[model samples]
Target: MKLANVQQPIRLGAMTLPNRIIMGSMHVGLEKLPNGVERLADFYAERASGGAGLIVTGGAAVLPEGGMGEVYCNVFLDEHIEQLRIITEKVHQQKGKIALQLFHAGRYAYKEVTGLDPVAPSPLQAPINRTQPRELDEAGIERTIAAFASGAVRAQKAGFDAVEIMGSEGYLINQFLSPVTNQRQDEWGGDFGRRTRFGVEVAKRVREAVGRDFPVLFRMSGLDLIPDSTTIEETLQFARMLEEAGVDALNIGIGWHESKVPTISMMVPRGAYVWVAQQVKEAVHIPVIASNRINDIRHAEEILQAGRCDLVSLARPFLADPQIVAKSVQGRFDEVNTCIACNQACLDHIFDGKVASCLVNPMVGREVEWALAQATVRKKVAVVGAGPAGLEAARVLAERGHEVVLFEKQERIGGQLNYARQVPGKAEFNETLRYYQTQLVKLGVEVRLGTEASADELVREGFAEVVIATGVVPRRPEIAGQEMPHVVMYNEVFEHKVKVASKVVIVGAGGIACDLSHLLVHDEVISPEAAEYLLAYRILDAKALHKLQTGKRKVFMLRRGKHVGTGLGKTTRWATLAYLKQNGVEMLTEIEYKRIAEEGVYITRNGEEQVIPADTVIIAAGATPNDALYHALAGRIPVHLIGGAKEAGELDAKRAILEGAQVGRAI
Candidate 1:
């Protein structure tokens, strides 16, 4: 697990990167009015200062008709040059190289966002976005090529070291490359050569605009993973054409927006798509950047040592820990916060039309606001609980030269995280827990496990400040047969404190309910250690391993709301729903919980009452704040309530961690 190769330098065209790490482009709407110029500049500069060798910015629309959303940067106008120059200048100040990713959304672009009709190779609509796009004629085709060339010229004028053309992920170039989207009989469609002509022309035009000295990277799909999409053999030919057309490097991207295959989720094993980069590297002499599910430096190093690719590109990992490279270089790998691939804040926030943030690192998008300052007066602080909130508060306070003592009632540290990791496809939570444990030890914070601190004890101990992050307690809704022997809470089942029969009915449909249903029905249960070993060794694909765990029982998930799993993150909701459907798990929504009995549970749906057979009943309605200690010591001490102790309406680790950090810095 030596990472010697990852620390080595690499060359792409005329630019010699300081290392092999590249910050891949990911859309995070940071641009605002007035001071947006400075905000965007500071955003990339932070990552540059953290020791990234090279950075590729998010998509910059080359044409108004090709814009994905209103929040994306626009390279189509001349006024954008000065605004973009700020980012390039700041990145250069940190001795970091940057590339502008020129994008054309094609059919995926929204007309509502750009106030122009979307255009593609043909009039066909994309499967994922489902927006009908106007077909490009001869004149429109020429305009698109010219627009891309103009974008490259602008990037060069802004002092960017390189420009990467977006040809992957079912965009305009991908539309022409796929027969399913481009059903035209014209020269830009039909056979492989004709289908690839659009991408090759754009590359040649961009190269001509920026000249031979400037680095030109092209991102292509190694595997489209969609119906009627271009095959790897066809993509390889397209790669050759791109190389011949003056593409200095190739970045291997897998799947598409509409692809059914799971590429980036936690269920996908780490480095699952490294083989894609290996195939492309074999076909081209140019440097190849491997992407998708690469979270650790050791994994990146392994890929490089095996000659799978020349460089490793990571997006979410940098969001989780911007100093990942610096920490690894200093031999502090255990302190690095690893991305769990939850997509709760990053992807889901972007989809919700908000600035992207991170679950583990709350200071992701708001780097300026969350910047740590030295505490003027150090005080003795007590953090009650060892959940995400308490851990973060203790870490920040200890880093600020405060004497912090973290108390956990459980024998092991991680509060609800211990139960969360037991669910399928959630072993990554352990990495977050490990990071906090390592940081606490490194910062010399006193950790007291299996110890509960009461209000009287805290007052007697004479602590300067007390942070009540006591977490939450499950709500036991009042029902007729709720006290029956068959009734149990979701946490009871996960902790193995209660036993259940094969047939189970779960009340309420949130993240907890969904996970419990999956756990109950799934046939094979793999230990976290075994799963991690398989993932590290690449012994079995996670998807395949998951398929082996066939459903063994009939489970029903009932929700009183209109939608099921409404509390789930937007990015992962689809996959979870699909998994439940595929396993024959019945999801009943907009129902009234009448009562519970030993043989079954009674529910009213659409004004009709019915009894659903169930041998076991699990309640996952919601949780309430455990604020007894805080209420008891309201005026006695300087008490501060945070995390679930403040609000526990939903399972929100994002708010819990962010609030903890905020309180820590304020104190």
Candidate 2:
């Protein structure tokens, strides 16, 4: 657990980092804020002080047309340099090395935000962008290469220690490299040599502009994960070309933005794409950095020890806990809040037009606003729930110098989260529980498990204030014969309180119902060890391995609404639905539930009534607030209601934890 390999100092070009762990780039939407410059500076400064060996900033557009919406920073603009310089100065003050990523969105640029036509090597339209792009002409290509060089020069002026050319993830450089996006017969496309020219020329120009001794990293797509795209051999060859073009190191990026592959999802195993980086490292003399799902020091150390890559880059993990390195170095692994890759708060938020934040660590993007200052007066408080909200509130309150006690009626903590961890591919929820457990104990919060505190009991126990986070309960929908012998709730299914049938029908197509359907179908859960063993020995390919983890049974999910995954985040909804679809789970929408019968459930679809045959039926409609205790303690003592106890519209852990932290700061 010493993480000796991760702690080893490594050199990227002329820069010697303190350790091998690199904080990768993440576009947090902070650059577009009114006080963006100052806010961004504080955000990076915190991570720098938290002991990041080196930090690669969010992508900055090298040119105006290449901008990824208005949310991204344009380093090519001279007006932005002074603001960016503040960030570099603050990070330098923390004694941490920082790199600016020069980016061009190509066809990925948003016409709605930038009000300009996107330009790529070919006029092919991006699936996500949904707009036809103008193919870059000969003159435009030269201008782009020059823009990359100028971006690097501007980064140096901004005082960045290094520059990372964003060549991966379906960006401009990647668009030119892949045949899927580049079909032109010009000098920059149609063949492998032409496809690779743009990236190499950009790298050579950036190196020339920055001069020798200035660190330059190229983020190359190790695996496009898209069919008929760049082959693995071509990817490695491109890496060699980049090194020859004077890139100090190669940072391997897995999957394109258009790829359906689950690269950074919870289902993706830790270090899943390390082999791709290993291939690039073998092909190049320069150092290589592995990204995608490398979430912790242990996994990073393991990869480094195995000589897979020279260094590892973690983006979302840094957002989950800025002090991931510092805490691990101090041997406080449990204290490190691990990124669950839920995408609920971070990526999903950005997609929802909100700034990026973490689900577990709510204070990520709000470093300036939500500072955890010490309390002026210490008081004893009682948190009457051990779910995410209560756990976070208890941890923060104790950290703010309060004597806190966390109560739970159940034997264990993590209220609804306990059931969430039981769902297929959601095992990372257990890590969130582990972190809260560690933090609560570390901050001296007394936990009373298997005991529910009443109003009089809390008042009599000398508690100055009470936080009611009693959580939620499964809402039973009004359906005839729903209480039949074969009928059970979703929680019962998770707790194994009832036997599940093979041909099952699930009522309500919310997040829980989708999860239950996923659980029931995927009976053959492949362990990570078994998967790695199968792949390492070439016993099975990735496609074959995925088949083994899919449905072993039949499931049908019916909802009254037209949309499936109604409450799920945008980042994960499509993928989850796709998984269910692959498992042969039938998701029916715009249906009316009549009743549950012995044979099956009767439903009306398109004004036609029919019975869906099933041996078992489950109601995962939704949940309602469990606020009986909150009502009882309302006027008797000072009380604050939070989480499901306050509102059960959606079981949102992001809002729950944020509320907990806010209340913790308030008290």
lDDT of 2 by residue, 1-667 (tens): 8789888998877889989999998989887788887888889999999889999999999988898665567787777788789999999999988999999999998888888999999888999987899988899999999999998999999999999999999999999999999998988888899999999999999999999999999999999989999999998888888888999999999888789988898888778899999998899898999998878798888899999999999999999999999999998898899999999999898877789889999898789788888899999999999999999999999999999999999999998898778887799999999999888878888999999898889988988999999988889989999878989988899888999987899998988888888888875677879999999999999999888877667899999988888878888888999989988989999999898999999999999999999888998898999999888988888899999888995568888998999999999
TM-score of each: 0.95, 0.97
> Model 2 compared with the native: what TM-score?
0.97
Off by over 4 Å in 1: 68-71, 127-131, 525-548
The worst-scoring run of ten residues by lDDT in candidate 2 lies at 68-77
Best by TM-score: 2
What are the per-residue Cα lDDT tens digits for candidate 1 across 1-667?
Answer: 4568988988788888988989998887887434765777777888888788889999899998897555568899888888799999998998888999999989988877788889988888776565688999999999999999999999999989999999888788888899888888889999888989999999999999998989999999888888777988888888888989999999988887877777887768899999988999999889999999999887888888888899999989989998888887777789999999999989999878788889999888677877888789989999999988999999999999999999999887888888778877788999999999999999999999999999899999988999999899998887789999999998798889998787889998888898887777777666668877887898878886676567668899998888888778887888888988888889999999899998889999999999989999999999999999999889999989999899996667888899889899989
